[model samples]
Target chain A: MKENYYQPEIECASVETLKALQDERLVKQVKHVYENVPYYRDLMDKKGVKPEDIKSTADLHKLPFITKADLRDAYPYGLLAKPLDECVRIQSTSGTTGRRVVAFYTQHDVDLWEDCCARAIMAVGGTKEDVCQVSYGYGLFTGGPGLNGGSHKVGCLTLPMSSGNTERQLQFMTDLGATILCCTPSYAAYLGESLHEKGYTPETIPLKAGIFGAEPWTEEMRRDIEKSLGIKAYDIYGLTEISGPGVSFECSEQSGMHINEDHFIAEIINPETGEVLPEGEVGELVFTSLTKEAFPLLRYRTRDLCVLKREKCSCGRTLIKMSKPLGRSDDMMIIRGVNVFPSQIEAVLLNEGYTPNYRIEVDRVNNTDTFDVYVELSPEMFSDTVREITDRENKLAAAMRTMLGIGPKMHLVAPKTIARSEGKAVRVVDKRKLH
Target chain B: MSVKQISVFIENQPGKLAEATRYIAGHGINLRAMSIADTKDFGILRVICDDPEQSAEVLREGGYITNVTEVLAVGINDAPGSLATILEIIAKAGVSVEYTYAFLGTRMEGAFMIFRVDDNAKAAAALEAAGIKTVEQSDMF
Candidate 1:
């Protein structure tokens, strides 16, 4: 615990101390948003809530909840809690589904965010002696900047590789003896394959640990990447709206990520009702940025589906832990009175010896939702007879039915027909939305 | 003896069979005989071709999913009930025939039938013992 934890005082803080800190920060943040941001102020007034109404974290439910739709409607400066001159930087999400989410940060907010990231790096055994390579794309993307700042705070010699350039990436990784690799899991998998093709085994890989996130990856993939890259891959969770990639991180226990609850208060709520669920119940994740000064959000609905539990960890940190997000609520589709997530289909596909890359096409005809998934036929799983191939397709569909509680029509197409995911793969094509 | 046959996976759409066969032909591989076993949405284009291993590899490089299977190449009388007789022998051997197609490139006079059975060794032995001529991989080329 001495070398593992970065801020033992805050990380290992007692429940009472953590609650008092959250109650204080939540009160201050509500007041700050109510006084400065008119959008949230208007929301509060509509809800008949005032800054005085929220006295502590217990009163957090009294405040109006903000959603992604609200953020988009607020657009540029509508959600700002501070003046433009005082703000230091603004990071934006790719915003593939909706309008870009631009999060503002003051110098103090940046420092606190970096501190959160530093705690993550240290949780994965990152140190000043380690050469940390940040391969997550920089610019508007928060991954590169977040990990880079954290590496600096930890005093590691930072390599801001900023994604792509595989040849040079391998060169620098081997030559510089980089110990920590920070990137998306897909990129890490690609790098591991490239390294193998270039005659470098997992034993020859210089990285001892990896901080992989910004996308969902299965535990099996994590073990595979760990074996291939010769590193203990760690999961780091964050969103651009909630101060980027250090909002929560995995400790040595590896059960679930310990959310930096001191800075960002994480909660689970039912997506349909907005009722707060009890701890350990899976629901949509709601984050209230308690310490974000420039863009302080109050009970912001993240729409990320997960579970949070505050169990006593062997790592000795009392921060409440959040399970790796099951799937985003936005990615869910209802068919024949049954809800199916594309991630569920993906899990079934992987379990059946197929690649996770698939296209889920959903259409509604005559008031019935038609669900179809196009899974690519890899060379390794090919068979000569139509019965043999059709048997596989039937088995996959049955597994998906068992997993999702709804059966989807399975199409086994030739490989290279489906588009591969580079960063975030668009897996769903919903025709119902079009109509 | 069993002959190597390459099967290419093709979606049941326009020009899929042409696309797969063209890929192998473009790689200078000559096709001997082929059959399409199709379902509602997809089909397997099974082919007896020159250089079966090389043809499958070429199709794979062209991004077509291919599988190689060893099938019995038995030469039978080019008359009525020839296929029935061979299948009866296979059934007597307690071997189930999965699929069968004609081998058009047989250099002899009799009709050559390709048989993919549950147990190739048992079926091949029974057919050969019943005076059916079993072709080898070199016999076609």
Candidate 2:
């Protein structure tokens, strides 16, 4: 949390200098994409814009916005700006949403990506003396390898303990004295619960900090994990389309994640009209990779709805900071004329002292939307009478109703009744889709 | 005196009950009496066993949400009116019974029933005052 913990030269760069650097990179990257990637060049032609028109960040709006749909249309090689021989690695999305997006990275691109991640690790006080354990899924999934490379760049002793094999994760974590952990937020919470079940307290573990991301997690969930694991939990943000797990990271301030503006340019746009929005407005987050060679996405729409902040941070980083995503614009579920994100339900539960492991079941019966939440009770909360338990359910329903602006029927089931996941937890069951 | 009863939370799925019982059986524990309270979405499996501590630990280790509760077990005559008589006595004493389950006692001539009440000592006193024999942990095992 100290002011000069990380690379102060880049993180604390002046706004004037950062903007000038971005202006230079924007001009070169625009021409590079137009000359090499035919798919993007065609998109630019359709917009009646040329690479010369985008001379700086001011003219960035003139370029056509690229989306995941474009990535899918192009498929594997359509977006590559460099030759296949020049690229050293390719990381793909899980294809859970649709077609997997494979991003090619040249050795230069990989080095820059790892440098960004190294800055993140350094921001969290990770040093060479620390043993960093990377628990994100490895291989085609970008989480593990991205952080693994980043931890190495930071000069920390790295433990490439890819996800699962949680028992062994704990063993190595304790045996080797891992001081930093990199994994998804849900997996961090799962590790906390597993440690508690094994009768290990925070003092028994040597982890001092954890960088959790790859999925949207609430601030309340962050606090819960921090308390359970007895360490500071930091949020790291990235997507396969942009880079990997280190596009931005939280400093000791923990207010928001500082975007690596030197390598990527971020903008907010109205998702419907595709018109750019001014700073501080909540809209779709779009990023243009300025330094990536093989796969440089120009104004790629991230689909994550959040606000961008330019206010000077306490950490002294002038880089633009982004709030944790509210929810993906597409993942926002509409039930009974109300917009509900699973995260709102999670925040409500964690505030009410329940674990974040829950299922939101939305159904429609006879033209009416049925919203029910199945919550797994902790062991302490499971022994009450039926009336007492029902009363608690009603209280939770009222709390969620107040937060979500709609009432959802709440069921407090026994502990572990709902499934526990080792990966991204499935939290919603929309039965209306079946009908 | 009260007896130790282990209650586990189980989903109302097809194999949940079998899974829980098999887990306890695998630990070599014998159940003295067992009952399940069912709801549309889930069920609570309550059991009295030869070793309640071990039973709870085994079920918890098997990933079941288990709790140990104190309940008053009363031995009554093996007649139709025996349960009704005890229920009325406890009702008059103002001790509300949250749930109750009965099984044949170790003795052939009578039956043993368990009552999960708000206050175990109060329920035991009320049942004993009415000449009903409230069983102890020793009586069950």
Candidate 3:
């Protein structure tokens, strides 16, 4: 019956105190970005704004919104606020066919990001005695490093099983008795299904809680994953662009994820007009990295569509809660914890001497994203032997994996099998009910 | 001598084999001998047909991935040791049999064995040198 929190004062602070903290941090962050990041400084200067123009969070709306386009334009080094020597690491976005946005982090930034994640793990019942297994894809991907560092900070025996090799995941989970699981919802679901298929019930499995995120998942999926694994499924949200998977997290109540408002400030804006929306009003989620040294973004638009609620929580954390992202304003789809764009697929097809006509079918099978890309086959590409055809398909899949980071099932079908669109082509068919 | 054998690439889903068979039958191509080697994702449907070229052409027109493989059709005598003798000769000749199946030869024989061997010409030469008659395409068609 011990009420637990990693950093009680910060996590359970009053809304007034949190607001004051955000305001103080926001003031310092604006000056930091303006001084160190020429890219952001130019952006602010273009809007005829200065560091002294911002006083508090109320003046946050005066700043120009930073979009993904800006991130792309800035590319690898334009937005880097600190010097390379001062920066400890850089995590690049999994985006294809363009210059990837690289988010830089100093050691201090890493510590804060991990601290945010530690609060998340603790909220989900992580303790010093617990063995936390982090199954997120490690390196370049934020899901693994963020949670793994947090687990270490929480004094849990960190199991850095960086995704895939499900057999080993199970072996270590049962043999080592991993008490907490950290990974995407889809992967967690897959693990649960795998364990059950191996005839291990919830009671036999030692895992008590799971923190799943990076991709959107539904409540039904949560319950299904929870039931299968016999663990409470908590959602954690973050983007590599915003220091990755520790920005917000869910507690025991699981109503919604609490945004770690101390390090990062959350805002919602009408995407089309760039006007701030009131609380409870659903819109595009924006973030401002307050304490980050190497990368401090000011009012950075997330492109994710979700609403924020400041109502009282049963978990007793006063952090502002963001509902699960309703959907994205853009065509970006998160499949198996990877950001996939139709343009990336199109780029692959066009580059590989294929027709633009293709169908991308995405579905949740056993809580894992099943991605199938059916490319319309030209007559010349047609073959009679399964061996030759499968070889060709595998080669295409390998190319896609190189481009997408995650491999897709390549199915070369008849030339006219894919339905031709009249007005516009509907390329991606995402069947996951994450909204 | 080697005869043409048709192999179709098919996904491992229920009714796919049926559909492929029906399509072949509808095109008036007779399946003389058939064998399906299945993997987790798909199945390779191989068949000795009355018209291998026509079957392949029709299947390709139907948008099915198909390929033609050359295999030997050896006529086995009506004796227990006859088939064993042919296998022993081929095994000694250093030619590997990838796969094999049987069908009644339309033109002749007690039993005709379709041998999908690594070296069909070599196996055929060994069979011929051993005094075993290998059926030609006309015999199966």
- Top candidate (DockQ): 1
Q: Give all TM-scores, in the order shown.
A: 0.62, 0.61, 0.83
Evaluate candidate 3 by giving its C-alpha RMSD to the native, one decimal: 4.0
DockQ for all models, in order?
Answer: 0.60, 0.31, 0.25
Give the top-scoring candidate (lDDT). Answer: 3
Question: Model 2 in CAPRI terms: which quality?
Answer: acceptable
Share of native interface contacts present in candidate 3: 0.30
- Give one digit per residue, the lDDT tens place, for model 3 in A149-257: 9999999999999999999999999999999999888888889989989999999988999999988888899889889999998999999888998899998889999
lDDT accuracy of residue A26 in candidate 2: 93
Per-model C-alpha RMSD:
16.1, 16.4, 4.0
Among residues 3 or more apart in sequence or in different chains, the pairs in candidate 1 whose N, CA or C atoms overlap within 3 Å are none
lDDT pick, better of 1 and 3: 3
Candidate 2: lDDT of B81?
A: 83
Q: Kindly list the per-residue Cα lDDT of model 1 for residues B29-120, writing each as its tens digit.
A: 88888888988888888888878888788787788888899999877777899889889999999999888988655477766789999998
How many clashing pairs per prediction, in order? 0, 0, 4
Among the numbered candidates, top TM-score falls to 3
lDDT score for residue A16 of model 3:
91
Worst 10 residues of 1 chain B by lDDT: B103-112
lDDT of 2 by residue, A365-424 (tens): 533468999988887787735566677888999998777766899987766667878998
